[model samples]
Target: MSPVNPVNPANPANPGNRVGPTVHTTPKVPVASSAPGVARPRIALSTVALECPDAHELAAFYVRLLGWEVEREDTDWVKLRAPVREDGGGGTGIAFQSDDTYVPPVWPGVPGAQQMMAHLDFEVADLAAAAAYAVASGAALATHQAADDTRVLFDPAGHPFCLWAAAGAGDGADTGRG
Candidate 1:
C-alpha cells in the first residue's frame, strides 16, 4: 500500500502536507522510567541560587569564604564554581541573582518581617578560626549562638549560615559531625 507520505508516514518532510499521528520529534528533559529493577536516573543538585541586592557582592563573600572562583558574572547575576574535588569532578555551583526587593532574613525567624528561606552549612577544623576568618571577610557573628562548637553568622547581605567544628578536629571532640 502507498502511504500518503511513504518516506515518513508519521510526519512528511513537506510541512504543508501533513499526515499520520503527527510524530513528535521533540526531545524530553530526560527522566528515568519507573520500571522495576531499572537503575534510576541520578538527579544531582547543581546549584543553590540566592537572591540578593547585589549578586556580585554576595558572590564575592562566598568566594572568599570557600576559596572558590567566579565562573561567570554579570551586573545582575553571578556564578561561583566550588573548589574542584580531589577526584577531578566539578563541585556544586553557587549562583546569586540580583533582587531589588530582597530583604535580609531574620534568624530564628520573625513573624511579620522576612524569615530565613534557606541557609548553607559548613564544616571546619576549628570553629573559632573559621568564624574569625568569616568576620574578617565582612561577615558578622550572630549574637544568638546556641551551640558550643557551632557558630552562626550573617553574610554581607544578612543571610545566616553555620560553621561547625568538625568531629575530632579542633578539640578532639565529636561535635556530632559538623
Candidate 2:
C-alpha cells in the first residue's frame, strides 16, 4: 500500500487500500444559554450528596462533628440539618447515600483505593481542641503541615475533610498559606 495523503486520508495505515479521503465535520447544534432570562428552570443549589458504603455511619459521623441533626433517614439516603447560626447564615445541608461498591479515597501517591476528591473546611474557636476532638471522634489525622493552618482529617468512612480556625478572629493562628 502507498502512503496516505499527508493532509487527509481515508486510512493512514492502509492508504489506497481503503475508500476515498475521509472528511471530518462538526455537527451543527444549537447552543443553549446557561444564564436565566425568565423561562429557564427555577434551578437553585440545594444540597450535596456523598456516596458512602454505609450511609448511616457516615451520617452519624457528620452529625457528631457539625452538631447537625438528622433531617431525614432511609436505607438509601440520609439528610442532615443545615447548620444555622443565630444570625441566620450558616453551612449548607449535607446528604449521604449508600453505595454498595463504594471505595474510600486514598491520598495522592498512596497505594490502594483512594477517594476521588474531598476538602471541607470548618471554622472553629479552638483549633487544637477541635482537632483533638475530631481525632477522638473516629477521624484520622491525614496530615498536619505547620505552614498551612489547616489540618486534613479523614472521616470514619475515609472521606477527607479539614478544620480551619477563622483567621484573625480566633485564638488559632493562621498557619495556612496566606
Candidate 3:
C-alpha cells in the first residue's frame, strides 16, 4: 500500500490529531443595527409608494414638481426616479400604484369623515412661487391654512400636500411648521 497522507483525517498515522477538509466559517454580519456607539436604530428610506386612482396623474404632478423622471410606467403602476448626483450615487424613488377603490382624503382631515392616512411635505426655497407653480399645475390651494409659512394644496387627485419655506433656502420665508 502507498504511504498515507498525514493531513487526512481518516489516516491511521495520527490517532489523536486528524484533518480531513478545511471548513471556513464566515463572520456573521448584522443586518439591522444601530449606528456605531448610538442607541437609535439605523434605517434608510428607499422608496415612498403611494396609491392613487390615476397613477399617471399623480406621477405627472410629482414629476413636474420635483423634476424627477419616470423610470417605469404602465397602466397599473408608475415609478419616478430623482436625478443622480455627480458622484454617481443613486437617488430616491417614488412609486404610484393604481387603486380602483381609492378615495380622496378630505381636507382638514375630519375624524368622523374620511381622514388622511398620510401626506407628502415639500420644502421649497420660495413658498409663494412654489404654491403658484403648483396651482398652475392643477393643484388647488386648500382653504384651511394651518400656518402662514406653509401653503397646503391639494393635488388633482385631492391628496393634500404642503409646501413649506425652508430656512437658509432659496428665499427665506416664515419658519412655520406645515
Q: What is the lDDT of residue 7 in candidate 3?
A: 43
Across 1-178, the per-residue lDDT of candidate 2 in tens digits comes to: 5456543364355332212122335434556666557567777666688888898998988888878899899988999978678998866788999999888876432435563454565766677888899988889987533234566678887777767666554655664333
Cα lDDT over the full model 2? 0.69
Using Cα atoms with residue i matched to residue i, what is each candidate's TM-score against the true structure?
A: 0.73, 0.69, 0.69
Q: In model 1, which runs have C-alpha deviations exceeding 4 angstroms?
A: 1-42, 171-178
Highest lDDT: which candidate?
1
Scanning candidate 1 in windows of ten residues, the lowest lDDT window is 14-23
lDDT of each: 0.77, 0.69, 0.75
Candidate 3 per-residue lDDT, tens place, 1-178, comes to 4345554334434332211112235434545556678798656776788888989989998888788999999988899987888999976688899999988888664556776766777768888899999998889999887666778889888888888777655556666332
* Candidate 1 structure quality by residue, lDDT tens digits, 11-51: 34424222111234654355557657877688888889999
Pairing residues by index, what is the TM-score of model 3?
0.69
Clashing residue pairs in candidate 2, if any? 105-114, 105-115, 106-114, 106-115, 148-175, 148-176, 149-175, 149-176
Off by over 4 Å in 2: 1-40, 109-115, 144-147, 169-172, 175-177
Q: How many backbone clashes does candidate 2 have?
A: 8
